[model samples]
Target: MVLLLFDFFFHPFVPDVLSLWHQEFDFYTLLLSVVYGGIIEEIMMRWGMMTLLVWLFWKVAARKKQVPPYAVFWTAILVSSLVFAVGHYSVTALETEITTPVLVRMVILNGFGGVVFGWLYWKKNLETAMAAHICTHLTMQAVLVISTILS
Candidate 1:
């Protein structure tokens, strides 16, 4: 909700990575984002990367356990989230000047969401994380469409 509100209200000041979707709102693109962004991102970031991190930590650091320790788990989440944030910045890097503020904002916002999704993946399931991510994109798209209509 906070991320949605930030994208809605302060878009002019701190544009989101998907701000282009607002300018050129296409149903197919929105659908693809909701579907693929939710599933694929979770698969890549959490299931793949975070899981790998945990496994590596378990194997290398905590040789006694099959599962990672709490510290290792949290560290994996942070690292995965940072990687996720970096991935989001790829599009922005092509057009905008990647400044300190932009980098900070990207890490803070996207990384926070990534961590939440990562936690969901850890606690519940990958499907839950994917559902949350899909809902987030849908909500953002809905707001963008409505704001466009109003304007």
Candidate 2:
């Protein structure tokens, strides 16, 4: 909910990453985003990257605790989110004619989503995070479709 609101409210009034979303808001694209962005991205960012970082940090930085410390977990979340943001920025740049504002927004928004997913993965299970990710994309697609219908 927070991430959705953030995207809806924070998107630039002028040209930005929303331009890419508006341009590519088709059934196929939506489906791809729901599946790839939700499933694959969660697997990579949360399951793979974040988990690895937590373990590594726990071992190295947190002095090999039996369980990961809070600091270790948070460090993992922040680093993985940064990575996720950079990955999105790189890929989005290739597809869109991104200005600085667009690129920055894309990085920040995706990074915020990454933090959400990472938190979910830590608190719940990977599946829970995956479901949230999928739902986010589906909800966005639904809004786009409804707006198109109304307009």
How high is each candidate's TM-score?
0.84, 0.87
Candidate 1 residue 5 Cα shift, in angstroms, is: 3.8
Give the alpha carbon lDDT tens digit for every residue of 1-151 in model 2.
Answer: 5655666665664355464335436788888988899999999999999998988898898774778889899999999999998898667767667777766777778888888889999999999999989988887777777666666
**Pairs with steric clashes in candidate 1:** none
Cα lDDT tens digits for candidate 1, 4-46? 6544444565545535335656799798988778999999999
Q: Highest lDDT among the candidates is held by which one?
A: 2
lDDT of 1: 0.80
Give the alpha-carbon lDDT of every model: 0.80, 0.81
